[model samples]
Target: MNSNQQNSDHWLVRPSTIRGLWIGGSILLALTVFLQFFIKIKGYFVVDGWLGFGAVFGFLCCVAMVLVAKGLGRFIKRDDNFYQGGNSDD
Candidate 1:
């Protein structure tokens, strides 16, 4: 095989990248689990501990963010002609 092909085939997946992903995912999972047990809103409109509420809330927030981003893209998105010839149609 050529040097280029060999290099491509043997490209390093750094341990740091793997470790970072594992740690990040673990933390998110742990937070969701922890929040499930210890989440309580004290005061008016208070909600007592509801199992899996944290995970559900987090998932719903993610979904809402994605939907909002998609909706905003339609209004705020621009073509390559944006900012050309001092035409700031933003």
Candidate 2:
């Protein structure tokens, strides 16, 4: 198929739309963090007062996961046709 046909028709496909969405979402998240101080989080652990802690934690966790996956891939990756032609007797 042609490039145009292969592309999706999603609303945020355009750069301007995606930029606007990112700006809007950042504003909304900032507002949420600003409003969080007045409220108390009944968590078993402290650091609840830290604004955007959850977002930071989740982002860091995902980055660490990707790094770990890449490190593991070095050990776990196999050559091409490893399963197709090799080890057929086993």
Candidate 3:
């Protein structure tokens, strides 16, 4: 590849950069969860006021959404040759 093509690659694609990003993100997430101890959360529900509740809830919700999407995909997905047939109506 030419110099321009080499330089065009995004920084996020690099292994070192990706590792650094993961570390930075983890630190930020930990900091937020740690702050929950000092900051009083005015939660509507008693369970939500617990330590790291928001993070756990958010992670669980994301997993549930992924599972729902996978389940829906099973019934809604079409075959690979669905649009490659001989007739337009088929």
- For this target, which candidate reaches the highest lDDT against the unseen true structure? 3
Off by over 4 Å in 1: 1-48, 86-90
Tell me model 2's lDDT, rounded to 2 decimals: 0.78
Candidate 3 lDDT, tens digit per residue, 1-90?
A: 787875788987866788999999899989999999899998899998999999999999999999999999998999999978867763
How far residue 5's Cα lies from its native spot in candidate 1, in Å, is 15
> What's the CA error at residue 57 for candidate 3, in Å?
0.3
> TM-score for model 3?
0.79
lDDT of 2 by residue, 1-90 (tens): 566854665767766788999999999878877777887656556774476777678779999999999999998999987868855666
Instruction: State in Å the error of residue 45, model 2.
Output: 1.3
Q: Write the per-residue lDDT of candidate 1 for residues 27-69, one digit (tens) a residue.
A: 9888777775565534333432455555667789999999999
Q: Which residue pairs collide in model 2, if any?
A: none
If scored against the real structure, what TM-score would every candidate get?
A: 0.49, 0.59, 0.79
Count of backbone clashes, every candidate in sequence = 0, 0, 0
Alpha carbon lDDT of each predicted model: 0.69, 0.78, 0.91
Q: Deviation in angstroms for 3 in model 2? A: 9.7
TM-score (C-alpha, index-matched) for candidate 2: 0.59
Ranking by TM-score: 3, 2, 1
